[model samples]
Target chain A: MALVRVISSDGAAFLVSQRLAKRSGKLKTEIETFRKSSDNSEAQPEIRIVTIRAEILRLVLQWLQQHQNDPVLPANQNEQDGRGDAEMGQSQWDRDFLAPMDLGIVMELILAANHLEVKGLLDITCKLVESKITGRTVDEIRTAFKLKSDFKGNEEEQTRLENRWCVEN
Target chain B: MDLNGTSKEVEEEVSQHYVSPPVTPEIAPTPPPPHLSGETCWDNLPPEVQEMVVEKLGDKPKLLRYRLVSSSWKKTVDMILERQFLSVWTEWEPFEQYPYKMNMHDYYDYICGYDELEDDDRNPTTGVILARAIIAGVPRLRPIWSHFAEHDRKANLIPSFDHHLPAVHNPKLGSPIPSNCLRIRFNDKIWPEIKRFERSRRAKTLADFVVKYDHCFSYLRALLLTDIEISPSNLATILGKLTNLRALTLEDTLLHVEPETQEENAVLPLHSNLSHLRIISTNSSASQLILKAYHEQVISLETNCWVPLFSKPYGNLKRLKLITNLKPDAQFRQGEENPFPALKYLSIIIHEGHVFEWDELSRTIDACPRTLINLYLDIEPRWETEEDKIRQLAMSQVTIPNVKTLGIFLPTIPQHAECLRRLILPKFPSVQQINLISGSWGCRSAIHGKSENETEVYDREEVIRRLNAAKIVAKNVERMVLELQFYATVCPKLEYIVII
Candidate 1:
């Protein structure tokens, strides 16, 4: 099994199985291009290092490792199914793993997942974040996340109005 | 040594004097009381980190609070807030009651930017493309022109003398124009081309046009016109003409009685190509009328408050969902008459009061048991009488042995969890996953501390115990999801329980 070196944004390096890394379309494409270049001897040695930040890359690799062999879903299948049986089955695990993490960390993971093109992880993380805000009031949400209120005067009122509309009929 | 000590002391005193009394504030000016107002925290974070923070907040209202931190932060927060709003609107289903309101200009902008619309640039307006496919028509530029002219007219709220200019040159003009001359002129300009195509004698041309723009019907897949009162004849005509429709969703559209003709008994033509059908209505008569012509070609059938006469079963249906007000007596009597046999996935939304009679329906389900692999039941409890509720609770125990996945909602009661444990565990042997959503204080109190009312509270250990007990009782269960909604603190176990 060929191992691929992944360098995170924070300069941390971890070796991941090439097969597992290929689960991410972005990494797969980069690897393919590197392999093509190496075949032509157009680049330096073939030690390909996929550089993504340590924090974000770690989550992506963990997810890919967990779901490496899962079947690629059909394009026309309902988008909801992208969450998949595996993730839905372990939704509580995913939820618990996310609960204690800083919102910033979760957001970083989401972006990283998006960048890596990890559909399952992206969907689950997005859903996790979406769940927190779906039925919550702006004030209550601010309190929970320790966010400072930025809106003032009319803009604030408009936001409240929009939120009320969202929550109510 | 004694003489040197005096000299050393003098040297020490001189060094202390040179040290300036440890830099003591000369006037001891009370350091301007640490200014607390202009403190910066999140602002000091790198822009990327700040963005990450904002994104983590996602659609939560907390992002709004970030604006109060500083002016620069406010701008970034506002931009993100707007993006989040638009993202939610685009991704999630539009609110049923107040569908996102857009004016003509906004609608035009949305259409222009719509990715699908870009794919068919030949048809400037998606609406005209759809209209062309609906009623065989010529695509004219006049509709777009008229729309803009009308918008300009409306914005100005003034009469335009040049509105009639489009009427003369445009090929889409209609005859017998209305008294609103400008509007009529514009309308006339647009209708002639459409009318010409409609009046075309060439069947091949019509068929070719239908195929060319058939994919335009995908736009109609988003329509939620439930309140529209549609005549059955009109519906039949419209639906019959929509040969390319893949999905048809009708929610509470009032059905008008069709006038009987000599061919009243004639069999209605079915749309064999329709792949998905979703019909939700409170009116049973309307439901029957809609189902009467249901083509067996559908792969997915979703109906709420409706039951079909299963005269011709669709063997290809993979998903069948029926949400109805259940009557125990009716269900029990209907045993042995399993309506949907080919359904691999089934979801039932049953009233809590009717749960007691679910066992009666199990006989019917048992007849075609093996095919159903997924079952979701939303049991809504009736909070009328305790004794009656207990009887219904007991009824929830009747299980479908073959169901692989089961979701149940229990009423909030002191013994609700225990009741569900007894009712559900034994009956569903093949069940791999169970989702149990509990209602307020009665169930939630078990995990979180008791409310001031001293209601039955559920502790985390208690919830875990109940789950373990339920799992033990269930023969083949692999995972359980316990969700408790409380008046006070939510159940801690819910946070840890893995949902399968």
Candidate 2:
């Protein structure tokens, strides 16, 4: 099998099978561009993804390798119904894959998956972040995400007034 | 923690991947993951990713909590709220216990004072206000209109408020109006409106209310209007304003007059944007409107009345369900217009009718011979003598070439097994599913209002034998659903038989 070298931001190089590397749309398009630009058909292409760190890139590759056989997620998933990850083809493996990651790692993975155009990884990671915020109260969420409440009394009142129908509880 | 330093350093390094710096730096300020466990906080995610997380929190209450989390989080929630804003008017009706309470039209008797308005009277105003208050703190305008407050109820005393005239108003949480998809339980001829006037505007007509809330109606998507009392013209006017509406449900709506009474058919304006139109009106006006105005665009229609449009050419109509009394007044015109060329799903329930005519139903199915996919026929066939005629009709006349799913609820007799095998089973060449719903036993006995000892044959074996006999004719039928009310013995006759 032909191999593709994927380089992370920290200069860590990982050689992955071309089939698994093609799971990332960005890499696939870049490989296609490289194939066209260079006449040498035998040389293995090396692509650098600078936005993703070495650790996060490793996780992304793990996900890509696992889901390489799965169908590609539709690009306009967000524009569809607001129902959660199930509609986006999230699976048990995906839930288990995200369960062990830290919140920071999950967030970083979301940015990395988005940059690499790995939709399944992006959807599952975003769902993980959403599951954190879904049922928790404002204080619980603030504590969970380590957020500082910035709105003052009057501005808070203004915000409350705008969302009158949904804030009954 | 040193973890924050590492995450921040990595975040800054990641930012270098972008060709240029973002215009607003604070919006992209890479906050160190602030959780005390030395983990990275979700504070530094981009606004787009933040929006995705909020959108994933589908329920309203959780989105509300996220809004209350912080100003930036609130902004993310607000962006979602803007697009998915739902406005609902629940036309509150008193339970069976309070039937004599003030109705939408006759509210004058109940309103003896300002507080004398019945529960239904306060539903639209308080409901919308409370619903909005659930979202916003205090909406600027309180547009409350009680249809029965002026005419049906008598206001003998002034209203009372907890806050005195001189107090700095510390209002509770709620908005009087929601800007998005409002699932309002609408009743009465009153249109939806909320105003800032000192006294309530009880006399304002629905026209005035619509004019006031025209902008709100413009953005409306899904509207569920229940127990609406309006003239056909008013309904047309209301539907006209909802230009972007996708789904409209009118339940138990009473038209001012029957459509047949009009000197000429009402030249109603078409709502081309409407895709799903469901009307539960006893009168045929709603169905008439679908036929006349929205024949070109409506995809799904569920109405109590069947119109002449079924006999006419309708290429776009996919799903049609009729739950009306099969009175002889149904106008099934034998027109040259090709009917239901694209119809895929059809469900017809004839109430309290014994005689099942072939021409009325056969023509429609015959029209869409190649297109009809799912057919559900719920009709009470006159028990004994009509069975022969039905069998002959099914055998000779009915031929739905492309029907995939077929459900027939008929009064069956043990002797009519041959009738089912010969007439019914062989008609559909493409039927992959067949459901035979037996009303009561093998035949109607004294238990089912027929004379006693009509044939105590409630045998599943007999039906299975007949179905096996019929299976020879339909080789393509993959599954068969048998819904028998009573049966003597259960048998696993066929691999595909699902007995219910």
- The per-candidate TM-score of the B chain, in the order shown, comes to 0.44, 0.54
True contacts kept of each: 0.01, 0.33
**iRMS of candidate 2, Å:** 13.5
Q: Local error of candidate 1 at B320, Å?
A: 2.8
Expressed as tens digits, the lDDT of each residue in B308-350 for candidate 1 is 3344556667676665665423442344545556667766655
What digit string (tens of lDDT, one per residue) describes model 2 on residues B339-425? 666777776666654455545444444544356777766554443466456555552555777776666644234434344444454
- The global C-alpha lDDT for each of the candidates, from Candidate 1 onward, is 0.43, 0.52
Give residue B128's lDDT in candidate 1 (0 to 100).
Answer: 37
Task: Give the true-structure RMSD of model 1.
Answer: 21.1
Clashes of 2: 52
Q: Is the docking of candidate 2 incorrect, acceptable, medium or high quality?
A: acceptable
Which 10 residues in a row give candidate 1 chain B its minimum summed lDDT? B176-185
Best by lDDT: 2
